[model samples]
Target chain A: MDFTYDDEQEALRDAVRGLVGKAYHDYEQRRQAVKEDPGFSEQQWARLAEMGVLGLPFAEEDGGVGAGPTEIGIVCQELGRTIAPEPFLASVVLAGGLVSAAGTPEQRAEVLGALAAGERLLAFAHDEPGRRWGASAEQVTASADGDSWSLTGVKEPVPHGARADLLVVSAALPEGGTGLFLVQPDADGVTREGYATYDGGRAAKVAFDGAAATPLGEAGLDVTASIATVQDITRVMAGNQALGAMQTLLKATTDYLKTRKQFGVTLNTFQALNFRAADMYTSLELTHSLVAWATMVIAAGDPDEVAEAAARASLQVSRGGRHVGQEAIQLHGGIAMTAEYSVGMFVAHLTALDHLLGDGNHQVRVLSTKVADYDALDPLDV
Target chain B: MIEGRELTKEQIVEAQQTLNAAGLAVPHWPEEYGGRGWTDLQRHIWLEELQRAGVPTPLAFNASMIGPVIAHFGTEEQKKEFLPKTANLDIWWSQGFSEPDAGSDLASLRTTAVKDGDDWVVNGQKAWTTLGQFGDWIFTLVRTDPDVKKQAGISMLLIDMTSPGLEVRPVQLIDGSYEVNEVWFDDVRVPADNLVGELNGGWTIAKFLLGNERVGVAPVGSTKRILARAKDLAKETSDGEGGTLLDDPLVRARIVELENELLALELTALRVVAHSADGEPHPASSVLKLKGTELQQAVSELMVDLAGPASVASGAGDASDLAEWARISTPTYLNLRKASIYGGSNEIQRQIISRTILGL
Candidate 1:
């Protein structure tokens, strides 16, 4: 029920902010970082690992810090504030989370240990071409060859797939449901085509031609539900990230409105623009409430509730992100449209986050089917 | 007895008494004044349940508007005189803050109250005096000094509705409801002791009262009830297909989007209430007003749209074959347009956010 972070969480935020903010406070610094191949600073990644952020969500026995959802949310938020192009969300929260969720004891100790130590980067190569956002994979199929398993299909737009040292792949099993597999970058029959994304990040068209893979936890067992739960957790974390991005966009817009002069005065002197900014603030706060609530729901540890909370938070973030992002550009006029400006990149990042898990329409469509199941939503129900 | 019927004033008063007897009428007030000393969240649940169950909430002016202000700012003698009566609905209250020229710029009100020997002579017109016809007393904001700033020169006065030269004239609304009125005072005399707070200090009290108004003004519970009802209406309605209007993807999508927005708003209200547990209303309470009213009006619009052509039959009598809900849909929709306009127009809310919260 409490939304304010405790002192320890505040310290964690300050620490992450200090690190990321120092690295990317200047727009050009971030630009230079994204201009290269790895798409993010390796030193920064190692620094986050050194700070134990990359281990925030895993078990201590698996070489992690074993922090709760709130702490992880704070880290994601700080990273989002700077729009740091690192794969903390894609690697640590998503791919690492899948491994932590479905990996066997031995597997967790090895893969997550290396991930936490910053020895490896991971990607969840689940998304496929012509498919909308979902929990289970379709194009990718897993075949059981007596004692081993291999995956064959394409996982296009696999976030950071080419750069990832390890891949947590979701594939449809020959028998029935989806299963999680661990594939190495150099595994046989693996081809990765990495490219720059709209939001100054990397995704690859990874084609697995019967790629040698090991099961995440139990061999040939369906892990669809685990994958879905992990995705829900990732969605809530993404909401936290979007909340941070919107906060910065709002501040940047307000700062611009105060300094940018036209019509013989600053832009804020016009009530028309001020009112729009006010609406943007309203959007940000409302979305913030939902995102924070969803994070709390995740902490509460009910998968069903987490699923619902994630959808609600994702919807609000999508709508709010669009409003604040678009208005941030409009209020700043043409400057925000330039690549050199931080506001446009923040907007681009917000848009990317919006479409990452599920957009507003997607969330609403999922929600509409169950609208009749309840008379009204009660946030305090938990 | 009041569930489905058009409640008479006496019935409304009796309902408040029923709630007041249970100490549910003014749970936001101090415990000494019949309040339950409930948390904001509990009070929220109380309000939502009342709306969902079709129970008439305590009259806003008596229970929410002036009662809390009086309990907080009234002198011991004033509280002793009015608090019990206000809580029990023995004295129906009406608001007298708005003037024709002071609609949004409320501080510019021209109403004047001059000090007399043992009384104050009040003279001015107050517009938008809601439910004024039933008012046994009126809480007024009047100009007490011409030399000071408009806001600084104002004071709140508790005036008896029967005071000499005081008149209430009903103003029919677009929805054909005689809910609002214009109250005029021609040198009406009020006992000096009837002043609620310090003289020329009403602006602060006015702000406190207005802030209280906006805090609970979102109508989250009622809007939610109406939206749930809209879903039902959509189900019963035929789309000229094998299925009902609920079968329409667009209808369901609209309902879903509105439901999601309402969910967000409800959660926002909870967040606001939680933060306001310290007694001062949270600044983000403005979001509740702005978004709350928009959703309220939006749901009403959805009801009208669901009623379709039958919505035009708002004047239909009991003898008509059209569903009662359909006959009333358009009128309800038209009436709710005032949701955003009243309780400090949504525009004023944006202004509050821009100036106070955002520092824009």
Candidate 2:
């Protein structure tokens, strides 16, 4: 029932805030970092690894810190506050998560150990071209030759795919269901084309033409369920991150209103503009509550409830992000429309996060199918 | 008692007394004053469960509004006289705050209570005294000093509704219900001892009571119940095709969106309750009232849409072939419009957020 962070959680938050805040406090620093090839600061990423944040979710036996989702969510929120151009969500929470969920002990130690040590980058190459977000892989098919498997398909918009050392790809199996595989980015028959995203982040169009791949865990096991669960978890974490960004945008809007003047008075003196800021605050607070609850639901470890909670939180974050983002630009007038300003970039990053797993419409569609399954949604019971 | 308006005064009192007997009617109050001394979360769960069970809550005037103000600011004699009776529903209290010219701007109310030796002669009118027809007493804010600030010149006086020179005239609402009244006082005398707090200090008590009103004003539990019922009704409804209304993507999407919003609100309420044990309402409590009422009205609107043409039969009787839910849908929807209007209008809530929270 408690929503406030614990003393230890607060300490973790302060630590991460200190690190990212120092690096991205000035908007120019984030803009300069995103201009580079990797789209983020390598030193800061290494510092996060040194802080054990990159390994916060994996088991210690798998060469990680073994922290719960709340702690991981804290780091995500901190990164979101500054709109840090890091691949933490793409690399650690998504790709590293897939390995921890579907990979064997040996593979987990190898992939996640290197990832946690900041020696390797992994990207989950699950999203393919001409397909809506789903757990099954239709275009990407896997062929098994004796004990080895090779993948043949195109996985476009593979987040951080070019910078990744290993690709955790999902492919349709010969029998049924989706199978998880690990492919080397420079493996034979693999093509990687990377470009900057609208949010000043990086993603790549990865093509696999009979690229040699290793099974994540068992050779022919169906990891479709695992893929869906990990995606759900990532969706919730993305919500946490968006909550942070919305918080900053709201503050920025309010701070601007109190100082920015037009026709001889500050913007706050205008009820019309101030009320919109109030609504943005409403959106941010609601999103914060939903994200916090969803994170706790994950920490509560109820697999059956995770998907629904994730979709609910994602819908709220999506709507809230758009409301706050657009209002921020509208309230600030012309300045927020500029590329150099951090507010618009924050909005762009929120849009990227919304489309990453599923946007508001997609989530509502998913939820609409089961609208009659329950009489009412009880947050506590979940 | 569906919607609670159909219940007689005796039935309402009996139900509340039954709850009071179990210490469930006023669990939010202090332990010495017939309260269970439950935490805010516990009281919240109690409310949600009561709503889900379709039990009519203790009268808001007695349980949520005036009862709390009395317990917080009343003298020992006043507390000893009214606290038990209020909790047990022995005294049906009505709120006499709003006037014709002072709805949102309540501090501008002209109701005056002049000191007349041991009695206060009260005059002026109070509008929108909901359920005043059943009131045994009324808690009022009246001007005791006309020279100072509009807010500062006010004082609270407890007046017996049966007193001479007092009249209650029912005001018909658009819903065709007699749920509210305009109370007039022409030199009605209230005992000087009936004053709940100090003279010219009613504004502070009014604010305190209003804040408490906002805390539970969301009605999250009952709104959830009605929405759940609406879904069942939608399933039984026709969409002009060979399928039920629930089969329509538009209807389903609408319900899904509302359900998601409700879940967010419920979670927000939980967060506020978790932090509100310190006695000061959480700043985010304003969101509860603003968003809560919007969702409540939205759910009611969904029902009328589900009923479609049948919603026009709001006047249908028991013998009518129209579905019971369909016949009542439009009126229920109309009645719920008051939700956003009361407990401080949604616009006032936005003002609070912009000024108090966002500091805009």
Candidate 3:
């Protein structure tokens, strides 16, 4: 029932907000200078790592700041304010999450420490040429030669693949099961062809032709469960980013409304249009609460709760976040349509986040089946 | 109004038993005075389950508009007679909010009921009275003082639907649904003791009802259900003369865009619900209403677009038994046209935001 963030979480928000304000006040310039660039600047990434921001969510046993989910939520929120080109989720969340979930002691040391130090960038190599997300995997083959495993198959839409030093690959086992393997980008028979995605992120189509790889943990580790953990992080972190993006979009549009004079009056003075802006602000806040709650549940290590929370979070971020982005862009008029404006950065990222894995539509389908029938029982139970 | 979603017989019995168990059966009633002590979220859980299962909110005319007004303003003796039965749906209630002459200009309602010995003889016609066909009783607003300006001197009265000279005729809307009604009260007799609240104060109560009604109308869960149908349907059929509808960039883009919009609104709804202080509604609730309704319509349009010609009819020649979808879309789309107009039109909402929320 308690909804307020603790003091540390508030401080985390203030700190990240300050950093984002200074570094990303104007994202359009950042996007242009870094367009199709390999990755986030090492200096900036190292600075964030040094600050312990990159390890906000990992336990203390690993090389993380040991901050709770709320703290990580704050970092994601600030990163979202700017169209942060850093693969925060792809590396820290997705890859780090897999290692944390299924990695042996040695695997955790090799991958997580570098990630916590921000010395290496990693990408998740799941979602092959399969028809939909979280279904059957068509790519990333795993065949065993003795106890050693070799992988072959292409992983498309690999976020940050071009810059990744480590790639967490989901491999299909010969025994009619699937598991994850830690593959090096420079491994033999592995080729990363780069492309720039619409959301201003560098992605790659990675073809692994019998590439040498090492299993992070036991062969046939639960990929779905591991990915669920990653998805829990992804949903909450994505929600955080969406919250920040919507806030920026709303603020920018609010400024536009105050200044953009038409029919001899500021747009704010017009009830006919100002209502939509007010609505955008309201929706932004609503989505924020849902994401905030999800962060808490994930941090608390409640997977069932996380599942419900993820569904709800995805529901809001993909649904409400999209509305605020659209209205904010539309309210900004022609300026928002052009790439030169920062609002476009927010719009593209919001849309990209909306479609990644699935949009609200897909989330609804996923969320509903989990509970085929709701027995209208006591609300306290939920 | 009975929103076309039907209830199962067992559910109807459950509803009756649940209501009968409560000392005060009014779903909208505040927690005190024998009502269910539920928060807005809990109440919403009830409504969500019902709608997601295609069960309408327990009798809206009673729970939403009338019963709350009576509970708030009724005399003790009036409560004794009306509140209990209204809660139990023992007496089906209908609202007399809009007349043909004052659909949107609700404050300008011309219905009149003059004072009489121990009784008020009402003579007026009300239109778009949802579910007037089943109304055993009605709560109406009458212009008691013509000398006063519009929105002033209106009195709230409780009248038995079967009173002398009262008539209810169903109005079939363009959706081919019999939800609304045209009710004529030709000098009908309503006991003076039946007036729930003070004269000239009905406008205040009516406004409060509008506020309470805002919480559930966004229908986020139901819209989720609709979007689910579209996604399922698109996966089966092609986007007309194409490889597949989902492969059709144009349709896919629209669905994705609408899905995103719907997600944003659902978050907005949760945020608004979370931000609500006490049980009282906020000006921001109006914001949820506006966006939520818009997204509902947009999702409906996508359902139709995804279904294409299949969406137009109730059935398909192939295994395309998208009957639930085909049956729902056109009506749902037509029903959503009022999104901009109801609970104080979106234009009015903007005014509230500009003047009330922003102090501009």
What lDDT does each candidate get?
0.89, 0.91, 0.73
At residue A245, give the lDDT of candidate 3.
82
Top-DockQ structure, candidate number: 2
Computed on C-alpha atoms, the DockQ of candidate 2 is 0.86
- Alpha carbon lDDT at B103, candidate 3: 69
**Which 10 successive residues of model 2 chain A have the least lDDT summed?**
A296-305
Error of 2 at A16 (Å): 0.2
Candidate 3 local lDDT, A1-382, one digit each (tens): 3456778778878887776566667675567546647755566677788878877767677777677677777788888888677777778877787788878887787678888988877788887765567733556778888887899988888888888898988877777656888888898889999888877777889999999888878875646676776776787788888888888887788778888888898888766567777767667666775687677677667677677667767877887777888897888888888877888778888987876656776776665453323322121233
Alpha-carbon runs more than 4 Å astray in model 2? B2-5
Calculate DockQ per candidate and list them. Answer: 0.67, 0.86, 0.14
lDDT of 2: 0.91
lDDT of 2 by residue, B1-360 (tens): 544236778888988999999878999899899887788778877887888888988898999988889999999999999999999999999999999999999999999989889999999999999999999999999999999989999999999999999999999999898999999999999999998888899999998988776456778888888888888878887777888999999999999999888888988888888788567878888899999999999998998888889989978788898888888888888998998888789898899999999887
Interface RMSD of each: 1.3, 0.7, 6.6
Q: What is the C-alpha RMSD of each candidate to the true structure, in Å?
A: 1.8, 1.3, 7.0
Error of 2 at B66 (Å): 1.8
The Cα RMSD in angstroms, rounded to one decimal, for candidate 3 relative to the true structure is: 7.0
True contacts kept of each: 0.61, 0.84, 0.22
Better of 1 and 2 by TM-score: 2
